[model samples]
Target: MHSINDAAGKILSSRQTVALTGAGISTSSGIPDFRGNNGLWKTYNPSIYAHINTFRSDPALVWELAFMLHDLAASTAPNEAHVALAGMERSGLLQGIITQNIDSLHQRAGSRNVINYHGTVDSAECTFCRIGEPVRRAALPVCSICGRTMKPGFTLFGEPVPPSAYLEARNLASYSDVFMVIGTSAVVQPAADLPFIARENGAFIIEMNSEETGLTNYITGCFIKGPVEQTLPLLVNKLNRRN
Candidate 1:
């Protein structure tokens, strides 16, 4: 029930504040969230397009989806929400961002300390040699050394998160004084556990989303309902005034 200004005050006062972001944060940039009313999952069966098994069996099919995503990402630009978070980090009010999104919008927005909890589309990795190459939208990106067909670096369904990213996100959540959940419903496992870990470690939890998520009542200390593009800038403005 706390206002955006109250949340901003908490962020400014906290010694260490971290943001956990998801597809919702990127929606303003025209990226679609995975589980919303118009989410990608609702249109495409994840098992067929986004599962590791599907990738192994039919990488070409998976690449079709990948190319579609790449095109979408290419056409989009970082929105105000992303810019605000990056500004917060630059000002030292926010320590870092942990994101479930595969798009590199946060990085594009100039957030230096970002943990890509769900990996990213910045490159494609060889399934055999594990070597990666920068994504090439004209055709499937391939590894230079082994010439193996490369897969997008994103964490596909049934694939575990990269260990280093997972550990860093967990450590941040455990050590933060304030943890903000932006545009995520907090239903996905592993990443969803971060807020609970933060709360248990005595960090205040804040949520900003267009609708009530599963964790809205259970974990949030402050719930500010709205689009992140609108809400985050207001919060940042409040923080700036306090500073």
Candidate 2:
């Protein structure tokens, strides 16, 4: 396993550094990842609850899951890993972050240049009227303006990620000199392609997770095995000491 000092050295020497974050990063903040052993998917079948088809046909059924997400986002706070990334951004060590989590914890932790690749749970919008509003605790949320059914800001399964977010994240990946993959197994597509893009562009890849991910053997140059909440802060402290 590569050390945190090694990851810190890469970050320090890189001209442009970017991060790709996943559900694992926010797990420390009390948000359960969907694919882990104890993830919400074990309790709730994602095909039924997270599919756009189900959401469009049976909005109320989908709202059951949405309401739970709303509550979780409301109750949770950004953990040390999120804070460490934000600190890196503030100090100009990290250029930006591209996150697959729907929870807006990175932004809450003060990361300014975050691209929410999976969308966010912080707001809702009407499909008919396109008017956006804050997420509320309702069995079935509706748009006040057009009285149409509301959907959470997150991209449900079968829904396309917003084009702008995809493009921006791609650009960040293509230009990074150091790319960090944090807490994600990175099995999902489009977002999963980012590490490869960085590698193609000559970015040194750093992987930080509790266990080895698919990228660990493939593109990862430095594998720092541990919980990101612990590993990330350690890396940041190393960078700070150097500074």
Candidate 3:
């Protein structure tokens, strides 16, 4: 088992290091995980609130959940884990961040090279004309171009992940010397497949999570068990000393 310091040292020495993050990373920022205890899924069915078909047929229902998420994102601040990653980017130890979250915390924390794999809540798209609109939390926003309701920019439950973000993330993972999986369960498709791509391409895979994930046993080169808020800062500190 490699120590966290050893992992940090490895990251410091690597030419390109990329991070893949999920809901767990934002939990410290007062956002709850989607599948954990007291998760949003427990109260709302994703089929109704999150699926693409539901958004097309009954957008109001999807907006109910969207409004709730908007409030949450508006109220929450970036946590230490988010800050640490942003610092790593500024220090040039990390190449980029590919996040499954739509909350925009990574951008808020000052990470410049963030790829939002699930899209962002800061804007929406008009379902009728496919025009983009800034998200307004004061009230539900309608499309100015077509007077149609707008859907959140995020990838819905049935919608495919955005092609450009997916391709860029894949390219980063393929060329990375160190690939870090942070707070993700590694169960979701497409995004989940990135670690395998990095592994196959000879990147050192690191897993940092509170508990073992589905990929813990097979894909990880090192597994550091702890909350990301605690573990990530420690890793960054170690990297700082080495730099």
Q: Which candidate has the highest TM-score of all?
A: 3
**Residue-wise C-alpha lDDT for candidate 1, range 107-156, written one tens digit per residue:** 99999999999888777888789777778877767778887778988888
Ranking by lDDT: 3, 2, 1
TM-score, model 1 to reference = 0.95
User: Residue 235 CA error for candidate 1 (Å)?
Assistant: 0.8
- Cα deviation at 56, candidate 1, in Å, is 1.4
Q: Which of the predicted structures, 1 or 3, would earn the higher lDDT when compared with the native? A: 3
What is the RMSD, in Å, between candidate 2 and the native fold over all Cα? 1.5
Residue pairs in collision within model 2 = none
Q: What's the lDDT of the predicted structure labeled candidate 2?
A: 0.90
TM-score of 3: 0.96
lDDT (C-alpha, whole model) for all candidates? 0.89, 0.90, 0.91
lDDT of 3: 0.91
Clashes of each: 0, 0, 0
